[model samples]
Every structure is written in structure tokens, then in C-alpha cells.
Target: MTLRDFALMVVVCLIWASSNVVSKYVVSHLGVPPLFFAGVRFVLVALATAPWLMPAPKPLWRILAVGVLMGAGNFALLFIGLKTATPSSAAIVSQIGAPLTAVMSFLMLGETMNRRRIFGVSLTALGVILVMWDPRGFHASMGLLFVLAAAFLGSLGAVMMKQMDGVKPLQFQAWVGFSSAVPLLIASALFEPGAIEPAAAAGWRFAAAVGFSAIVVSVAAHTAYYGLIQRYEANLVSPLTLMTPLFTIGMGVLFMHDPFGPRMALGTIVALAGVLIVALRFNQLVSLVLAMRPRAQ
Candidate 1:
């Protein structure tokens, strides 16, 4: 990747990290119904990207399936999980998606992973197990499980996306928005009784959070990310996103007053280390090292 693309990836990570915190606030703090919040956010995304929906990409069913899996299925579960899961922990657990994506790519996309990558995947799983471990047992486990399921859905969608063609970022976002919004809204109405009132009571804060999530996160950050995914291998792009959990942990502590005990810290380090190892090819690692060295004087 060019330096410019690297910087852009960093920016996207920040946007995604910020979005996690904001979503946590909306669902956990503001008491917005998770499905409702997710539905509305995607509704706005659909409206914003509606223009790009035209000349709809071929294999319409695949596009819709990807939209439902990555967009609605992922966020719906994630928001629901966030109602109980802390932003920091949720962020860490979400990293499981990288390994999941790697596995899926290997199985579905004909990608090959050597023993090093396999070890990295195992290490990542161990770290996530540490993070998900709670002495209290089931209290937080259910929420984390939900997040794990969300990651599975998202990873599957991403791998499926790799098989697709001619789907621009905005166009993909448009389909995701539209396809996700309808089902999410319907589910919210059916399951989350009195969901709308609390969101209405949240007033402008709710509006602002949804707007930021829809416009900045789903549209700008995710669109840029999709473009990068198109331009590079998934493993190459996935490692850089480790920055997101770091940013989330900081913001969660500073803004949301999230607890950061030694266990969580260690888990974060281990998990990130594993993900970094899994995602970086030896050549990429060498390049990164070379890039960090002093330039010719």
C-alpha cells in the first residue's frame, strides 16, 4: 500500500473506533433499543446513498445476501451485544472477525495459510477466550457470544464480497443500507416494545449519534474500507485495523468510564499481537520494518 493509502486506513480505523464508542453510548447509556438504533442508522444510510443504488450490480441476490449478512445481521447482533458488553471488550472480541475472515478465505476463496498463520489464528482464539472469561460466568458471556456471532456473519459477508464483481463501495453501501434497514426495523417493532419512545426522548443526542454513524461510519469510513479491500488482499488490510481496538479501549476508558483491569489489558495485548501476526505476511512484515528504518542521508 502507498503511504497515502496507509494514512487513509488509519483514518478509517479512527472513524470505526469512534463509531463503536458512539454506538455504545446510544444503546447502553442513552437506552436506545439496539435494533431500533441500528435500523434508523441504516435507514439514513440508504437515503444518503440511494442515488448509487441505480445500475444495480449484477447477481442481485448475492448483493442483497451480502447486504443482509454484513449490514443488518452484523450490526443488529453487535448493537444488541453492546447493550451489555463494554465498548473495550466488544472491540477486542470483534477482532475475532479477522481470523474468521482468514479461515473463510482459505475455505471459500482458495487462499492458503501456512503454519505461521495457523498459529496466529490459534493464538487469537486463546486471547479472545481470555477476554471473554468472566469469573461471574454467564453475566457477560451471552453478550460476548452475540458479538462472536455477529463477527461470524460479518466475516462470511466479507468473504462473499470478495467473490463479487463491479460493486462500487457506495453502491454496495446503498444495498446494505436498504436491505438491512427493512428487516431491522421490522424486528425492532416486533420485539422491542416501547423502543421508539426512549429514542424520541433522547432528542438531538440520538439524532446526532445516528447521523454520525450513518454518514461518517457507514458511508465514508466503510466505503473507503471496501475500496481498500478491493485493491488489496484481505489479510493485508485486516492487520491495520488492529488500531481500532486500541482507539476503542482508550475512548471507552476516557469517555465511557469503562473498567480496564489487568486481565482486560493483557487480553487486549495478546489478541492484538495474534491478529497482527496472522494478518502480516513475511514480505509485508519486512516491508513494514524497512519503511520504519531511517532514510538514506
Candidate 2:
């Protein structure tokens, strides 16, 4: 991990974090339809990365499935959630994807779950519950529920991706863009009638947001992150991504005026801590977890 690479990773995290705020603004504030917004973003992503689609990965069916799950399914739900969920709370809730991936791996990939991982998973769930707690009950936080579902789909896609081979980041992005765009566009047309009107009203702002999200965040930042993954160890790179939600929470406060009371703060800390635990490798994780336990006399 050179200092430059670390800086690059931080930049990548910032880009990703800003995306939440951007999406929230476009959907919640600008009034763009969520499915329509996601569909257009993927359409642009597909065009940009279309060249990489060649020499397509095998098991095309699985690739398509992963694409829809990670790309359209995940982001469509996220945008929908952002319609009502603040970026700050949504960011904290999204951290559940890390532990969800771990659990999915255990269930689908025959992976082992040690004490640390189990504890981490439990903590993550607890944190999400705390963050989602509403005195007004579930109806008030329906958006967060959608976000949770999105996280589950994304985690499932990640677990499925582990079985894939020879799929470069750009190539994967290309497939995801193409596969996700079709269904999303169709769904938007069907369910969100006159979706284009709001986008038209938004004009260049909408185009700019979608372009930034598609090209810069999805294509460029993700490709750079994947390059780092190839260069560095996964455990090292993975934990650093926790910076994303922190950045999102900060940006949400500064830009969106999102409320951040004590409960939200505590939930963020606990959720991020759990994700950090889940991201750690076996040796480091065991040592940390063991240290936390009371010493026997």
C-alpha cells in the first residue's frame, strides 16, 4: 500500500459516498423517478463499457443474474429508498451488506463462520435495528426496509460473483449495465408512467447526475478500486471502504441537512465496527475478538 494508492482508495471512497447524496438529491429533491433514474444510468454505463463485453464470460445466465441482482435490483431499490431515507441513515443501514455477504457465503458457498464472524453478524443486525427504530412504527421507515432488501440482493450477488472467473471489472460492469438496463427501463415504463417528465424538468441537472454516477462512480471509481484489489490484499482494501459510510454521513449532514442524533451516531459506530470485524482476516479477527473477552482468573 503506497501512500499514493491509499490516497486513491480514499478518493474512491469519497466518490462512492458522494453518490448516495447525489442519488438522494436527484430522487428525493429533484423528483426523478427511481427506476427511471437507475435505468438511464445503466444505459449510459452500458454504452461506455460496451467494448469490454467481448470474449464474454461463460455461463451467461449466471452473469446476467448477477448483473441484475447487483446492478439493477440493488440500485433500483436503493434509489427508491432514498426517496424517503436520508443519506446518513441509509449509509449506516447499507453496511449490513458486508455481514450479509459473510452469512450468504456460509450458506451458499459452504464457508465456515467462526465466533468472530457470528458475533460480527449479530452486531450488524442489532445496529441496523437501532438505526431503523421509529416511534411512529414501520410505516414511517418503509424506505429503510427497501434499502435493507437492496443490501440483501447486493450481498447475494457478491456471493454469486465468487464463483465467477476471468471477469474483469469493466467487463463485469458492461454486462451488468446491459442486463440491468433493459428490465429497469421496462419496469419504469410500466410502473412509473410519465417518468421522463420530471427528468425533462430537471434538464441538465438530471443528465449531469446520471452521467457522473454512471461514468465516474460506477465505471471509473469501481475500476480503480478493483485495480487496487488486484494490487493489494483483499482484507486490507476491504476494511478501508468503511470510510465510505463515514464520508456519506458527513456529507449528508453538511449538504443535505440530514438529522444525526445520538441514536444515529451510536448505530453508525456499532454497524461500522461490525463491518470492520467482518472484513478482517482470520488471524487478526481472532486476536481482536479474543482480546475483547474477559480474561479467566
- Among these predictions, the greatest lDDT belongs to 2
lDDT digits (tens) for residues 182-207 of candidate 2 = 99999999999999999999999999
* lDDT (Cα, tens digit) per residue for candidate 1, span 1-297: 899999999999999999999999999999999999999999999999999998987788989999999999999999999988988999999999988998999999889988978988888888888899998886657888889899999999999998898888899899999899999999999999899999999999999999999999999998899889989898778778888999999999999998999888888888887788788977877887798799989
Candidate 2's TM-score reads 0.95
Which lDDT values do the candidates have, in the order given? 0.91, 0.95
**Model 2 RMSD in angstroms:** 3.8
Q: Report each candidate's C-alpha RMSD, comma-separated, in the order given.
A: 2.4, 3.8
Candidate 2 Cα outliers beyond 4 Å, as residue runs: 282-297
